[model samples]
Target: MTVLDDSTAPGLVGPPHSHGPRRDPAPLLPDPEPVRILGTPAAKTFDAELQRDLYRRLVLGRRFNQQATTLTRQGRLAVYPASTGQEACQITAAMVLREVDWLFPSYRDTLAVVARGVRPLDALTLMRGHAHSGYDPYEHRIAPLSTPLATQAPHAVGLAHAARLRAATDPAAAEDLVALALVGDGGTSEGDFHEALNFAGVLGAPVVFLVQNNGYAISVPLASQSAAPSLAHKAVGYGIAGRLVDGNDALAMHSVLSAAVEHARSGRGPVLVEAVTYRLDAHTNADDATRYRSAAEVDAWRARDPLTLLEGHLRAAGLLDDAGVAAAAKAAEVLAGEIRAQFDNPPDPDPDSLFTHVYARPTSQLREQAAELAARLDADADAALAAATDAEDEAR
Candidate 1:
């Protein structure tokens, strides 16, 4: 009997049909070594003023993380996923976007949200157990802090695609608008991640997915989480560009993310950037990091802290002096103080807000539920009033 070879089969041969334009994967592949700027010759060429600003933000971000962790301990916050060692990725992600652009951040990205002009208190509202997102997403062009893994990826793509479509008819609508979604390494395993990238590549949506691969997905090491060469390599599978950078290198992260944002804005389709940083704190206040990671591992990463790395570069370059360091520290302290004061007496959210934005036109069932809630609230108020009146009558 003769066996048929699969390579000679009718449908197994060459690229005979065209589905769409074929892209060169070589251009999309990330560099073998993660990009670095701090402590390198490239650091000399970066803008001094911008570097100074970035350093200030890093300082503020560090303080913000510390205060948030403390708040969790004090029971002021329900939970906080501190970005202690990933300040560079967090702050750079926010700074790269234009005011018109949108940001979709994960639950661990309160630093990015705060860096994007959101009040610290508002950024922590969800962690404070608020019913509604503390800040108005429409006003800030930012989605709520997504607690669900990879869910914001699709939302970012949708917004970017819609903006691109609008720009086709009215150029003014675009205004170089793009969407940047920040996700953790763990989120990459989700189906939504694959779907978002697939749609983004096919539709040529103007969006950037920044994966902060901080070594672990809450305790599961990257080795166990993914077998990909690197998280950035995953982008090439979707026919989009990929980039890798030292997540702890503030200058490099800013540079890489800035270029990625512009690339998306110019309609080059989506880009995926994997920032190789480390998470210094536990997943949250409740998580015992010691249970999973060794102390030496944490110490190793602490030495390469984003703040210390950037500060050393700045000081060595004569861009930052003792006075500058002191000033940055002072500013950071002020921010920490503000966070403490606000969280010490956080205002209670309106209970009715739960039903406010649930739907554009409330369904009958929703209306019925809202009415029932209101009735209960009214009854409680009436009972309190009657009890107070009775107490006063007894005193008389």
Candidate 2:
């Protein structure tokens, strides 16, 4: 049944010695440094670049979220969600992915979107209830942000499946692309999450489910989300590997996400990562955290704050020197100025666009209404102009 080809396979294109005295693939990866609780051994990756990046990224994300929240409150935005303390989960995980990988983010994943190069202004379109969002996600390797809880997980699975198909067909597109879908802790309670997990596992889809464990689903805490001790353990039901990382630690997050991406590329199936972090802000512009939670609890979580922990490690390692920290702070100040400038003078609506875009040919009812409105407006304008002219003639 072999249709033999004289030509060798593309990857096998090497001189006869390319295989060079076969060696067992060195252990897939060196054993990773163990997780640290608070400050045990510091997780080994707390070096200069990692520390600086972690600190600046958290600061940048926080400032951006705060500015966006202010924009919403000032009636400039329709709505907004702050990633807030979950910056570690978003920014560092974005660093773990190659530009070719796809990200399916939720409404709250604006920082992750920014990390992947989506502009902050574009994110506001969706929240502002625009007819169409301004962001072209495919151009940025991001899918549209899903507001429907856990639904995007399956879309991530579908994207991975599509990548697998292309890899099998086109040599040019063969590098396996891992698709990541970020979801909230409450989202995992949906049936869609289970279905996506089982399907991705069965198909060996290169996908990662990043659960941002911000401790609550609005007012409900993780205690009520699921009975599993940790959400990552849910991977067991699908016979996939999973890990729980201190989501507040960017270095630890990157270490785990890099491993998960490698595992998925090797066709090991999807990996579930439960990132343990907290949401310092309300679920959105509408929700009130104080209504459901006590001040002590918020202050307590803030004490183990992600930014403070990263700053401590940075100063300890001499990566974030006082000068560098000052530079980052000033840069953030500039960024705030830019966001304010944009919010002050935003895009104007094309009023008649309501009937122009939805269908190439207008429906009968829409056409009739549009014509009536246009004529009525024209008649009113004519009457106003005539009245003005009459007043001028009398004055003359």
User: Candidate 2 clashing pairs?
Assistant: none
lDDT of 2 at 125: 73
Give the per-residue lDDT digits (tens) of candidate 1, residues 305-329.
9999989888889999999999999
Number of backbone clashes in candidate 1: 0
* Residue 204, model 1, lDDT: 95
RMSD of each: 3.0, 10.8
Candidate that would win on lDDT: 1
Candidate 2's residue-wise lDDT over 1-396, tens digit each?
Answer: 223332645444435656535423222222233244336575454465666777898888778888888989888888888888888888876788898899998888877887888777776678767645658978888888888898999999998999889888997878668999898899999999999999987788999999998999999988877898678878877767767888887778877888888888778778888888899999898999998888999999897678788778777766667898788888888878888886677777665777876788999999887888888878999999999999999999
How do the predictions measure up, each by TM-score? 0.92, 0.83
Best by TM-score: 1
Error of 2 at 178 (Å): 1.1
Pairs that collide in candidate 1 are: none
Model 1: ten consecutive residues of lowest lDDT: 1-10
